[model samples]
Target: MPDAKPRLIVIDTDPGIDDAIGILLALASPAFSIAGMTTVAGNIGIETTTRNGGRLLAFAGREDIPVVQGGAAPLSRPGPEPLNLHGENGIGGVALPEPVRPPESLPAAAWLAEFLLDQPAGAVDIFALGPLTNIARLFIDNPDAARRIGRIIAMGGVVHEVGNVGPRSEFNLWADPEAAAVVVSSGLPLVLVPLDVTRRVRASREFAQALRVAGKPLASMVADLVESYFETKTHQESRPLHDPCVMLFALAPELFRLEDLHLVVNTGSTEEAGALTVDGNGTPVQVAIGVDGPAVLDLLARTLTAA
Candidate 1:
């Protein structure tokens, strides 16, 4: 028999196309029992992101997981305009019926803080796939609760590659550099899945074909998005399954190689703004440098289709 799985987790995300896949991965994996989902403004505005998050849960037949809307802008920078990568509405331009379930009463930051506090020490793992604004605010409001988390696995930064948003920053970290700084310096155990590793991994044409062959509506939708995203971007034949890598690290750490390093966010200078500058000194956080890409793709495909 497989070992018992962890019980409590909270996902803080901004419903990008890849974010949808990450959410489905968490809901489908028996390793985690999702406590709730909190939406932040990274891929789109807070309202749209929260609604999209709720829609995914509703589509997955998991309306029981409450969704909460959080910070509309970063702690420092003015909110970034939505990117076209996930379409104007986010979620791969594939709109489902409007979600019937209303979001939870509390804002995302508050819900995240209170929920973490309510769980036993080291019991809750936070998977953040967007700007860290909400998570930073939670730490500021409830430091003790933030400290109680077992670990934070995040999908941001560009430690060893050129930034996607600028010369030095990835989109998520660039969206909220101040928030990124706060969370990285919060003294919690953190595992960072930066663009360095994610860029090396891609969902190839074969993988997309396989997903399409699954004949499931959600899988087909994702496959189509991957195809569209790749075709529109220069030299990009495949889309990186970015956010899912963070969840994969948490659910299957053995699939990755991790190194401890000091990461700093650059909020100044127009040229390198939002860059995550890692110094190999000071308090070190874990950063993923490599992964079993083919295996991860297989895992993602099977999990999404698992009954």
Candidate 2:
């Protein structure tokens, strides 16, 4: 670990297979000091994701960190049925030990609001690894706290790559277009890690071998889970690691090309809801356009193996 100051972060997540990878990455890296995790509804419901957060933390031996349960659904419209892409329990069906600790008593927004207010201006960054519902509500329900945030490093939206949901929608934003709209329009500082860049940085089928060779508990467990994920995925040669890439950017923003753009989300259209459009009149934010894929893959592999 370098002697540099650690970045204090609050992770907003919905723990799927990739989400598990992302959270573990952060915990492994010495560059970040995770304040806590706020769980939202995405790959699964609040119940499963909240539980999964605790399980991941316990597995990582960081049970001291709190897992605060966020919104069960989006701002408006019913959320898509819990996705099976992550497996029945939303962590690739790998059975981690039940968490010895439970979730925080305060709801996601309230805890986030208090945490934000207590911190100095721009003291803590937010890694939004899931849908924007909890984050959007923080801006809507607590504007003062929202104003003090350092930045929102999010993994959603897609510029050049095809959408994961509809023709223009990614799963996170599509899960709650209304919330995405609110966050985009709120004028908070944001760095978006969309599919355009995440698709470029991936783990191949060989990643499992690397993890297994490391022989560390975290690495070995992730290896088993990822191999399970590979069973259902295409192109086993290259698996786009979405959430982990977002966390990586937080550690090394210099590795990516971030461009400031006025971006908008589609809340009015049914088919194109959550679609991100580059509009001059939209909110100005930093969008990651390019990255050194090989460098990122190397760093991730080195970290996970050493973790």
Candidate 3:
């Protein structure tokens, strides 16, 4: 019998530390059957992110899942070389074997389009944890496939809180605001996990210690990475689990408050490159306003620690 879960998700990401946690949580949970994962450049370059995706899957013993490389740079933007947020390798300086499985034959955008088309109508949910370049490209090339996707749960933008990359923009959207503008305006059902809510959820020392004691290798690694990242940032005592929050929305909608509103991305303004400006007039996309942070942490710890 097929799984009764309502979601067939495709992860489009740049495997930063939080992205690694998000992927583990999704793969660990029975609520989702991750169909495929496509990598893009964001926290790091496409090459590193792609390699990190493969490394993560291998670490989770999910080598069977295909990891395809996507766009190396955002549309109309210069390529962003890998950042050091997740250490040199984007995995907390932890080294792992390269994936035995090669990427899909086609580029990520084409592969994503093909997969969405092959799935049953409204069966696929896109979990975009990085820039929107690949997704935007996919839509441009295959409008039919774009329409087939059930919804998109993205981690970007800043409605009520300060943006991470700049005063008005977050890293993911800042990487390619034009692409973000296209995706949000496409009228697709979107569940946005903006910084407003994500900023409020923190992974504290207590949480990190608990994760380390959980006895799961992945959980321990995640904890270490979070701890390291937390040290570098202003909020050293508490770090936002930004990317994973998007996956948590998919795994447990009850953990958050969803408000449907119209959202726009600021691509033209130099001062607000990746700003996710919400339309005052009610729009149709679902935006996450609040989240049960403690509950989410518990869920993440449990899932990542499970044998």
Candidate 4:
């Protein structure tokens, strides 16, 4: 008999440190069938994010997953400089061995459309951990196909917390505000995991230290990555594993509290790019507002350590 079908998750990402953690968690778990991954420019350029994603798959011994290169810049705004927070090479500069596999021939947007369009409706769930460039492009080019997506769980924006990139914006949406605006208004079922709740979930140094003592290579690598992320912060003693939270919530939404709200992304104002506005009568989306932070960290540590 053929293997049972696990839920298909297609990730559109920029492989920052947290992104690496999220990918690894998905690979470790048995509930997900990673249909494919498409890289976009956000934490870094598409070239580097694509390479890093390939390396990550190799690191997890799952190189069969198709990786595709997506947009290099935003639709309308000039791209931001690859921030140093993720180190020079996006995963805190920890050298992952070169991947034996290369990305797909078609650009990410094209590949995503072809794959999702061919699948049965609601067969694919998109986990977007970076800029919405590739996703917005797909929605624009093929609205009918885009609507067939089961759901989209995106890690971006800010509900009540202060922004990470600018005074009013988070990095992923800010990197491509025009794309984000399109996505939020696309009427696709989107669940926004903003910085509001993500910042509350912190993986502490003690947990990382314990992981470093694990006898596995992946656990050691995770420890190093977590430590490097902590090092980038001057004020915080613990690090927020942002992208992994998105994966976790996708796997189990009951773990977090969500609110339905109509949202709009500010794409027109250069000075206020990526500012998210919530209104009673706007584009509807679900926002994750509360999470069991300690439970999540425990789950993350256990999962990565076991993997």
Candidate 3 residue-wise lDDT, 19-124, digit = tens: 9878878887778888889999988888889988998888778988899999988888785556777887886776677887888889998998888878788999
Error of 1 at 20 (Å): 0.8
Cα shift from native, residue 197, model 1 (Å): 0.9
Ranking by lDDT: 2, 4, 3, 1
Q: Extract clashing residue pairs from model 3.
A: 262-283
Q: Which of candidates 2 and 3 reaches a greater TM-score?
A: 2
> What lDDT tens digits, residue by residue, belong to model 4 across residues 22-133?
8888887777899889999988888999999999988878889989999999997678899888988999978798887999999988888899889999999999999999
The candidate with the higher lDDT, 2 or 3, is 2
Superior candidate under TM-score, 1 versus 2: 2
Against the true structure, candidate 2 reaches a TM-score of 0.97
Model 1's alpha-carbon lDDT is 0.83
The candidate with the higher lDDT, 3 or 4, is: 4
Cα RMSD of predicted structure 1: 1.9
Error of 3 at 97 (Å): 2.4
lDDT of 1 by residue, 42-65 (tens): 888999999998888887788888
Q: What TM-score quantifies how close candidate 3 is to the native fold? A: 0.93
Q: Give the alpha carbon lDDT tens digit for every residue of 1-307 in model 2.
A: 6598988999999999999988988998988999999999999999999999999999888999999999899998888888888888998888798886899999998999999999999999999999999999888999999989999999999876679888888989999999999998899999999999988987777877888888888788778767867878765676778999888898788899999989999996587888999999999989999999989888887887887
* Residue 258 in model 4: lDDT: 99
Best by lDDT: 2
Instruction: Provide the lowest-lDDT 10-residue window in model 3.
Output: 276-285
What are the clash counts of all predictions, listed in order?
Answer: 0, 0, 1, 0
